[model samples]
Target chain A: MEIMELTALELGREIKKKEVSVREAAQAFLTRIAQTDKVLNSFVTVEEEQVLQRADEVQSALDGGASLGPLAGVPAAVKDNICTEGIKTTCSSRILYNFIPPYSAQAVLQMQKQGAVILGKTNMDEFAMGSTTETSAFGPTKNPWNTEHVPGGSSGGSCVAVAACEAPYALGSDTGGSIRQPSSFCGVTGLKPTYGTVSRYGLIAYGSSLDQIGPIAKDISDCAAILEMIASYDPKDSTSVKRADCDFTAALTDDVKGMRIGIPTDYFGEGLEEEVKQAVLQVAEVLRQKGAVVEEFPLSLVDYAIPAYYVIASAEASSNLARFDGVKYGYRASAYDGLHGMYKKSRSEGFGEEVKRRIMLGSFVLSSGYYDAYYLKALRTKALIRRAFDAAFEKYDVILAPASPGTAPKLGQSLGDPLKMYLGDIYTISANLAGLPGVSVPCRVDQNGLPIGVQMLGNCFMEKKIIRAAYAFEQARGRWQAPPQAQRKFEKETVSASADDMQRKEKEMRSASAKDVWKTEVKTVSASAGKAVD
Target chain B: MANKISDETIEYVGILAKLELSDTEKEQAKSDIERMLDYIDKLNELDTSDVEPLSHVFPVNNVFREDVVTNGDERARLLENAPAAKDGAFQVPKTVE
Candidate 1:
């Protein structure tokens, strides 16, 4: 098998046995990224020299007889929202286009300490505000399975990187299905840990109360391993939790005997695509046959999740994003009359339409006349949603639902209708509302050939239950195959030109100080230039 | 529940958010906010009168730490990414002329 085909753990084992050098593994994935990422748009920044340098460092550490854990030599992608020291972490927005962090996120530090080779940041929705990655200041990431469709977001680039085999695993932050929905759309596995399980420090807060960083990978095992490496308690983030039961890999057993899996009947109702519903139900069947006790149950307050989620998340986002004025680190208006003018013009010019809408919505909900009606009511609804999940968990160990209403939608279908996009998050947002751990495992491919995911949500801090269930489901499902486009090898001559062009564009971007030049350059460099294979 | 968000409200909220919106964007924002508020009104259907507000899902209290210096000053490094910095501090436009 090719090095790109190996799971992260598999590659780590080969490196440990001296069969594969860390440099070789990193190079193989980097080469794959060079060839495939043009079409996928899976990456925002890919520093080839830095990646190789990290690989060499890991190789030296391995040669010196130091064990750095399972992810030692793995090349992992991080969503651009996460801070990386000396790297431009833009969160796929123009406001932070020129901003470089002085300190790395706690998760990035954890990965670095484990000797993992950082493969640069992946694109995401601008400040992680939208369901489709199309809202990014950078271009949207196309689904690997089909280029016309979106790889769901705000973790689209991370999911696309893994799905297209550009990277073996990636770190994706979830705030209301950002990780799980994209994982489903891209035919990958993603896990959003319970609130505070992973430190939120330097994650570029969108909705602080709901956002939790997690892992997206080729399968549940890789997700578990990646989660194990990055999950930690940091004093920097006040919400970071210290957990004694964080050994996620230990729950990889195939046994789900007598495990109670509750399928929410509400999730299978109207608006759910028939094929998607069947695919999720098939997961229930597979688990049932494997000795899991599967039954349908009513998960109350299902319809209220989206509105409450939007209200609360937007309120938090308004407060969190208030930091990005022209003064501190980020973009500044070239000309402004005064302090207030600078703030207004910089934010107005920097933020995209979707971001502006959310900010306005948040401002409205929290404004004087509307706070008690909209903001406080949403909080009360949030409490009731949590109580509903608490009650459901009393009877069932894990609740199973469809990750999205259906498979991946076409690239432009979601953005025009913001409410339609918001409703797409119905199935997955409740987990964030209740602070539950949720995992999305690809169940089956729809008639349109896009993959559908079965989401397993567990009560707070019960990551093991969902992971075990997902792992068991994966075992039953057998090995997943990458999309034909990703697996197809192009002739070297056809690939080199586009790859070189991309490399040159990246170089020019690094040298250029003007943000407008960078934006125009990105827009002009279309991936369609390398479409000779189809 | 206000089904219709007035143009005045949008303008006021724009000022609160520190966003300068053109007339086109203001109209767009007005309709969008109206639609979203209409949808958010769904939450009103479920009587949450007895339920307490849940700001954070987890029962985490305010974290406390001793007042001890963790690291030496890195003022230069901190100022590296500033759009306008001088004398080892962020420089903003004059608030009072």
Candidate 2:
């Protein structure tokens, strides 16, 4: 069997039947990461020793005739922002470059408890603040579909890891569109659970109210299985909800009969790329053909979502990030005269440009004079958006829209302009603001051979409805074909070797001056309101 | 549309955020902050007088657990992440005169 081509569930079954040992699966994935990650830059840290140790433990348990968990022996990756014990969780910023957590995130513990072997910590936007992965203090994670383009972020690395088949599945957080946007860009299935469904105990807070950790996998069923492992209430997180026992995998029926699917007309308005709109509309047709009730509806309060999201997310980020001063933990300034000076210099030097910009925007909005004008206004707008969603949910079982306005852009296309970058998130941000369960599944590929995703939004705790619908669509559409870039044979590259050589030389030069220039560039870019809240 | 934010405001905001900024960054921050503010000012078009502000999405509030420790002490492990540690606690620069 092609190890990289197997889904998590399929690999688990094979491991149980003794067709593949845990160690064999883990070793294959680790080797793949070593070979492909250099080009994709998906992982920030890969712990080979720890990974092998876990695999050994699983193999021993199996030898003792133990019934394995749903994800038994499946190799997985995690977003860097989710704390993993004994491993560095950098959030792709210099501040936490050496900050290793003493404990794993609650979601990660649950995954490990289910016999999942963590392959490594994947890279992400700095502090999960940017749209594309370009703002990472480490180099950007390239799109696996097209190496020249970006994988959408701030969960870009997680999406890339799974899409590149470096791991069977990976965990990602969606404060806004971090999981779904990248899943769409890289042509995979990702689900952003309802706001309070997944525990946030160890997820480094980007927007506390908006953040939820979810899964990215090759198919929706694999995502459902992973979600089952992690979705539980924890007393550690006050916002987490007590859920009834749910079998998300069972919800993967190929039936959408009698389902009421709402298509948001406002999502198809100006700025939505023509191809993405047609693809999503085509999804509506597919669902209708499956005996579901699909209709166009005006989702009110559409224009205010992006603005409200930025303001509220930035404000929360500013407050949450105040804990990062050099006095306690994380990076401390090497040269400083006093406590206050150290705080200033450390933050100035520690953070990347995008992170600082968000901190600035957050502080400005929550500052004394501007609090009511910006922050309070945003809160009210958030309330309105939530109310609008609630009203819509009363009518429709699920809402459908484009995951992103278009396919992934070139790496630096949105980096130079902040507003343009923010606009790419317009379709995905409202679900976060409303605290609704949202998912993205790859439906079609655009002319540029990039993936396009159709998003589904369901009411709180109604993930079953959306998952059932997406599964039906997936069944009808068939699984996405691996992009050409993903299937590229590593050894027989004849054309791009000189280009690769030039890139290697450039990388050497960049790494030489990266540290000094990183701090200065961070300061320079901190003034711009970079992408906010995941 | 051109440079709506003033430099003095950026300085005050930077101080509040505990970030040191150079003159060039201050200028960049001014333009960026102004552009963002201008974009966010779109909310001013609607009347939100009757709307209640929502700080959280869920209705649950005052979630209280038994006031007891649920986790073991891991002071050494926690301190391992500290940039500067001494005497089993995080050490910082002098605060007193």
Candidate 3:
């Protein structure tokens, strides 16, 4: 089998058995990324020289009889928001276009300690503010299932990297539904661990309390292996949970005999597409047949999840993102009369429209007079939602639902309609709001050939339960086969399409004046080019 | 429910956010914010009066550590990313002078 097609664990086992060298495995995937990622637009930065150098180090370690971590020799892609020493960590925003971190995030350090070779950083929404990667300052990531559809966001690129076999496993951070929603759209397995389970020290903060760094991989076992390596107690992150070492792989037994699964009927009402609802219900029946009890229950707080999530996320984002004002680091305005002018102009020029909109909404909600009506009210509602989850957990071990309301929306369809786009997050946001562990696993494909995912949400720190249930379901259903469109054997037309895109961007940059409302667009396109060339 | 956000409010919020919006953009923001606020107003239907506010989902409080240095300063490497820097400090437009 092709090295790129193996699961991370399989690749690691081969590397250890001397069937394949670490460097050879790295070369195969790096070659695959170069040939495929242009059409996918899944990566933001790919430093070939640095990647090979890291692979050599891993090889030397293995040759010297030194025992490496479980994922030794596995090549993984990191989302751009996570800092990597000397790597350009842009958060897919112009504000951090030239910003390179001096230190790596704890997650990256942990992965490296385990001898995992670094693939390039993947694309994301600007500061992780949008549900679709369309808000990316670089460009939108196309769904591998069908190039016309979006691979959900703000972790779209990371999900696509796994789906397209650009990388065996990749890391993505979730705030609302970023990881799970995109994983659903791209037909991959992504886990958003309980908020404090993984250290967030160098993850570019967007809704600090909600953001979590987790893995996106080809299957549930790969997800568990990656999680085991990264989940640790760290003093660097005050919010880091002080949990005992998790034996994630040990929890992967196919015996979910007496496990109770709750189906929130509200998740199936109104907005959910019929196909998605049916797919999740079928998974529940499969669980029932496997000796697990599945029942339908009403989660009344489902309707309030979206509003509360937005209010709280935006408010935290406004405060967390206030640091980028052209002073210590990041983008600066070329022309400004005074300090205040520089701050305003720099921010206005740096952030994209969606980011700016969220910041403004956040500022308004937290403004002196409206705090009681909006921000505080949302917090109270958040408490009630948590209470509801706590109450429901009293009767169930895990809750199952559609990871997304439907399959991947066509590219550009969710754009221009902010409300409609926000609704796409309704199914997954509650997991983040309640600080639960959630995983999205591909269950079946819709009639459109797009994959539908079943979400399994466990109570805080109960990732083992969800992983067990997902594994049992996965073992029964077999691995999801990638469609022809997903396999990225680069054809000549893809290169031409990429070139056409570049030219179109150059035209937009030229026609746009310094004062245009789309000034950020021009700046970002140009800055993104510099990123690619550098 | 009616839209509660106004043009004046959007303008004020934009100022607070340090974002400069054009007339057309302002019109768009007004409508978007109004619709968003109107939708979020659905929370009023839920009676949360008895529920305590949850600032964080996890039950964590005052994570403290010893007052010893755990990391060394990388001032030079950090300044490498700054748009403008003087001899040893970040340089910004003069506030007084």
RMSD of candidates 1 onward, in order: 7.1, 5.9, 5.0
- lDDT score, candidate 1, position A442: 88
- Here, model 1's chain A TM-score works out at 0.93
TM-score per model over all chains: 0.94, 0.93, 0.94
Candidate 1 per-residue C-alpha lDDT over A288-386 given as tens digits, one digit per residue, 9 for 90 to 100 = 999999999999899999999999998888888899897777777665556788899889988889989999999999999799999999999999999
lDDT: worst 10-residue window of model 1 chain A: A525-534
Can you rank all candidates by TM-score, best first? 3, 1, 2
Q: Which stretches of candidate 1 lie over 4 Å from their true place?
A: A489-534
Candidates 1 onward: DockQ, in order = 0.57, 0.54, 0.58
Candidate 2 lDDT tens digits, A311-410: 9998899889888886556677666656788789989988877788888999999998899999999999999999889889988999999999889999
A296-394: candidate 3 lDDT, tens digit per residue? 999888989999999999999988889999777677766665678778888888889899888988998999999999999999999998989999899
- Chain B TM-score of every predicted model: 0.91, 0.88, 0.89
Fnat per model, in the order shown: 0.85, 0.74, 0.77
lDDT of 3 by residue, B10-34 (tens): 8799888887788998888888788
Off by over 4 Å in 2: A491-534, B1-3
